[model samples]
Target: MGLLVVKNIGLLLTMSNRLAIADAVVVIKDGVIEWVGPSAEFDLDLYQDCTVIDADGGLVTPGLVECHTHLIFAGGRSDEFEARATGVPYAEIARRGGGIAKTVKATREASEDQLFELAVPRVYSFLAQGVTTVEAKSGYGLDFDSEMRLLNVAARLDKATPVDIVSTFLGAHSIPAEAKENRAAFVDDICDRWIPEVAQRQLAVFCDVFCESIAFSVDESRRILKAGLLAGLKPKIHAEQLARTGGALLAAELGAVSADHLDFASKQDAKALAEAGTVGVLLPGCAVSMCKPDFPDPKLLQAAGVKIALSTDYNPGSSVTLNLPLMGSFAMAFMGMSAMEVWEAITINAAAALDLQDFVGMVKPGYKGDLVIFRGADPVGPFYEYGGSKVAKVIKEGSVVVRRDPCGGVTI
Candidate 1:
C-alpha cells in the first residue's frame, strides 16, 4: 500500500470523456490513485523510493467490473443447458424440476465449507480475465437458511481473495418447489423474514428479484424490492429477461439502482429508466448461450440517453462462461455496441450499475488502483481481437494479481 508509479503507458483508456491518452503516467499511493496524466507532467523527485512499473508501451485501462453474476452455486446445470438447447422451455423445465430448482437442491445439500471452496475458483476465473470487482449473487438457495449460508460463503470469499466481491441477496431468484403452491405466503416470508434478516446481519449490500413471467411477477418483484429498500438495502432486479411483465417500469418507479437482462424492454421503458436515473445492465452471454439474439434495442436505449452496462450473468444453466471479453465480443456482434461503448459497459458503466461509480471503473485520481494491461495493438485492440482479449497483467490495489504468459496461460 506504499507509493507506486506506472510510467510509459502507450494507450491509456480512462473510460472518461477525455477518452484515451498517449504516454500517460499514473501515480498510486496507498492503493489509491493519486495522480494520472501525461508522463511528462509527472514529478519524479516528490517520492524517489516509490515502486515503479513500466507498462512496456502497452495498453492500460481500468480493471473490468462484472456487475452481474450468479457464481455462488454448488452444482452445474449441464442437464438443463442441454435440455434448453433441444428446445425445451425454461418454465417447462422448471415445472419438471430441472432448472434453478435443481441447483437449489444441490446448493442446500452442500455444506457452507463446500460452497466456499466452490466459489473461490470462480472468483479467480474472473480475476484472470481482468475483472477486479464482481457482484456475486446468492439465488440458487431459495430458503432463508440456505440463502444465509450462500451469502456468508460469498462474504468469506471476499475476505479470501484479492477481487472485491459485492454480495447480493437474490432470495427471490425463483420460488422453491415446496413453496410453489402458496406463492403469496412465500413472498410474504421474503418481505418480512429474508429482507430484515439480510439487512440486520449485513449479509448483502443489494437485494435482487428475478422479475419475469417464469419467475416473480412485476407485482411480486415490487413487493420484495420495496421491502428491501425500507430495510436500508439497495435494490436491483433481473428485469425483462424472460418477458417484459412491466419489470422495467417497476424498477424505475421503485427507484432501483439497476434493471438487468432487458431483452424485452420497450423504448418507453428505456425513457422511464433514463428519467428515473437507473442504469440498464445487459447480459449478452445469456442471450448467446440460451435465447435468440433479440436483445434490448441498444439504439433505443442509447437514443433515450440510458446508460448501458454489461455482465456475464455467469450462472450454471444460462451463461456458463466467466469471460468478460467474450461478453464484450458478443455485445459488439450481437448487441450492436461499438468497441468503446462495450468497454464502458464493463468498466465505468458497470460501476455505475453497482452504485460504485465513484470508486472503481475508471483510471482516474482518487479511485482504487485497479488496472489492466493488455498485449494489443492499441486501446481497442484487445477488445476487437477474435479469439479472446490478450490480457497481459492485472493490478489490483497496486499489486499484480494476475499475469499471463507469452503462451497465453493465466497465472495468479
Candidate 2:
C-alpha cells in the first residue's frame, strides 16, 4: 500500500458545508483521501511506506475544474480579436464567413499530429494555473471528419498531458459550409451519421449543440439534443449567449448536466435552471474579450438560487484565455460575484457541472486526492497576484504533478 501525507496546512478550504478548516492535515492512500482534519487528530504511523509533503502556511484547496472550454483546435484567431475590437460585431464577421467557420476550415485542414502539438502547450498552460481537470469540446470541427479528428486529438492529449481531459462531441456547433443552404439537413446528418459514429467509437462523453438565433434555432437545438440523448450520450447546451431562445428551459427539459454562456438569460431561464438543477456556467472572459456592452447578471441567477460556475471559455474566436483565476476574477469584478462564490464556481460547482463532484471537487476523506497548494498564505493571493503564477504545487491522484522550488515547504 502507498501512503501520502500533507501536514501543516495553514488554511484549508474544504468546500464543504462547513466551508473552511484551519490547521488541517490530509491523508491519502491508493490515490484516495483517507483522512482530513486537524493535524493533531491525524495518526502518522498508519501506513508502511509513506511520503510526506509540507504545505507550510500555504493555502490548500481542491484542484480547479474547468467545465467548459474549446481547448483543442488548429491555429489562432488573434486577427479576429483585432477586427472585433475595431467596431465590428461577431455575427457580422460570421456572416462574412468568419468565427467558428474560419476555425472549422483551419481545423479540418490540419493533420492530427499537427493538432496534438499545438494543443499540448495549451493544456500545460492551464496546468501551470492549477487546473487539473478540463472539459474540452470539439466544436471547431463542425463536420464529421474534422469533428471526429478533433475528438481523436483530444483523446490523444490525455496520454501526453498531466491534466485530465474530458471530451464532448459538438458537431452541431454550427452548420457547415456545405450544409449552409440546408441547415436542418446538416442537423439530421449530425444526428444520423456523426453522433452515432462518435458514440460507437466511444470518443466523447457528452454531446453539445449551440442553441442561438444565429446558430441553431430553438427547435433545431431541441431536436439535436434529443438525438444525442437517445444515443446514450449526455446532453449539454451552449445556450442564451446572444439571445434568450429558451435554451435554459430546453436544457432542463433534456436533463442536461449543465448549460453554459447565459449572458442573455431571462428571468424564466434563471428560474428554470434553478429548478432543473442545471448548472449555470458563466463565461465572463468572453465578455472581456469581445468587449460586450453587458455581462450576465449574477444577482438574478443567485436570487433564483441557481448553482453557478465560472469557466475560462477557452476558445479561439471569443475568449483566448486559459486561466481559471483570471476568469474567476472577471466573475468577481464584472459579474458582482464574491470571492467565495467564484471559488465555489471553479472548484465544487465546476466539478458538479462535469458530473465529477463525488471525488475530485473537495479535499475530503475518501475523495480523489486532487488538490492544489498555492504559494501564498491565503487563497485570495492566487487572484490578487493576477498575472503571476501562484501554483506552488499540484497533486493529482495522490501524485505530485507540478512543484515549484521543491526543496522544503509546508504540507497539509
Candidate 3:
C-alpha cells in the first residue's frame, strides 16, 4: 500500500513502439506507477521507506488483460469437445441440443454461490498466467433472472479476486428453447425488458451480441445493441466467428468498442473497424479447439490500419483455456502475428478493447501498478516456449499477488 519498487529488470516491455528496455526499474506509490526507467538512474537511497522486489534479471511487462471471455459459466463441455473430434460440425452439434444451450441449462440450474465458487478457480488460472483484468460475459443466461444472476456473480468476482472483472450483458447470446417458436418476441424481451433492467440496475458495463447464422441476425443484433446504447451500456459484438453475417459492419457502424472473432471478416470490414476506431479482437484458441484452420488475417487488419487485440476466448464448449501466453503462441504459429504484436494484443490493445487503456495495461507512470515478471531474460519466452508457466511473479495494485518457485510451486 506504501512505496514499492521493482528493480533489476533485465528486459522491460512497455507496450509502446519503443518496446523493450534493459536493467529497468519501476517505482510505485499507493497502487499507482510513479516512475519507470533504467535501474542505474534509480537511486534507492532517495526513498526512505520502500519495499523492494528484486526481479532477478527477468522479463517485466504490464499485466495481461483478457478482453473477451465467458468466465462465469457453470459447466464444462468435455463430451461436446469429444463429439467435435469425430468430425461433427459446431452447427450440427448445436442442432443436436448442445453448445451454448447446454451450458445455459447448467448455469440456470446453479445457485449464485455455486456459480461464484466455480468461477473463482478460473480467475485464479488467469492470474497464474499474469492476467490482472478480464471481461466476463453473461451469455449462458438467456432469461432475465438468470442473466442478472450471472452479472451479480461477476460483480462478486471483482470484489473477491485480485483481478478486475468487467461485466457484459449478453442476453442476446442465443435464443432459448422456450422462445424458439417466437424468436422476434424473445428479441423484444431482450431489448424491451432485459436491457433496460440491466442498465437501470447498473449490472453491466457493455452489452454484447453473438451475431451469426446460428445466433441473432444483423438486424436483431442492431436492435439489441441500440437498446443497450439507449440505456447507457457500451456495445461489443461477437462478430463473424462462424460466418460473415454483417456483424463486423454493424459493429463499425455502431462504433462499438470491439468486434471479436473475425475469421470471416473481409478487408473492407477491417477498414470500417479502423475508421471507427474499433479494436479487432482475434481469438486463436477457438480456432485450435474447433479444428478450424482459418484465423483472422492480422496482416490485412494491420494494412487497413485496424488495431488488433488477442484473447483466449475461454468458454465451456470451445477454447477452454486460461493461458493467455498459449494464445500468443497460437497467434504467432497459426495467425502469423509477431511476438511484439502478441504482447500488445494481450496488454495495451486489449485494454483499449475494454475501454481501460488509461487505467491499466501499461508500465508507464500514472498507470495501475500491475505487472508480470517472467522467469527469463527474453520477453518472448512465453510465446517461444508455449506449454509451461514462464511467470515467476505477478504484481497487482503495487503488491505481489502471485509467486512461483523454481520447482513450479505457486503461492497466491
Query: What lDDT tens digits, residue by residue, belong to model 2 across residues 1-412?
Result: 3788988888889888636877888888888898888887877787557899999778898989999999888877787788788988766877777788788888888998999998998888787678899999998878778888899999998877778899988888877778889887898899899888988998998999899877898799888888888888889999989878888899988888999988888888888888888898988888867867577777888889888889999998888898889887777667788778888999999998888889788888878888888776676777766756677888887888877664433231
TM-score for candidate 1, residues paired by index = 0.97
Span of 10 residues, lowest total lDDT, candidate 1: 288-297
Q: Which ten residues in a row have the lowest lDDT in candidate 2?
A: 403-412
Clashes of 3: 0
Candidate 2, residue 268: lDDT: 88
lDDT of 2: 0.84
TM-score per candidate, chains pooled: 0.97, 0.95, 0.98
Better of 1 and 3 by lDDT: 3
Q: What is the C-alpha lDDT of each candidate?
A: 0.88, 0.84, 0.92
Write model 3 residue lDDT over 1-412, tens digit each, in one string. Answer: 9999999999999886646889999999999999899988989999879999999999999999999999998877888888888888777888887888999999999999999999999999999999999999998989889999999999999999999999999999988999999999999999999999999989999999999987899999999999999999999999988888899999999999999999889988999999999999999888767766776678888999988899999998779888999989988898889888899999999999999999998899999999999999896789999878899999999999999998889999
Candidate 3: stretches off by over 4 Å: none
Cα lDDT for residue 68, candidate 2: 94
Query: In model 2, what lDDT does residue 357 have?
Result: 84
Best by lDDT: 3
Model 1, 1-412: lDDT tens per residue?
Answer: 7888888888899987747889888888999989888888878788778998888888899999999999888878787777777898877887887777788899999999999998898999899889999998998889989999999998999999999999999999988889989999999999999999999999999989999887899889999999999998899998887767899899899888999988888989999999998999988777656855565557778888989998999998888888998888877877788889988999999999999999999999899999998885375676678556588899999988898987888889
Instruction: Rank candidates by lDDT, best first.
Output: 3, 1, 2
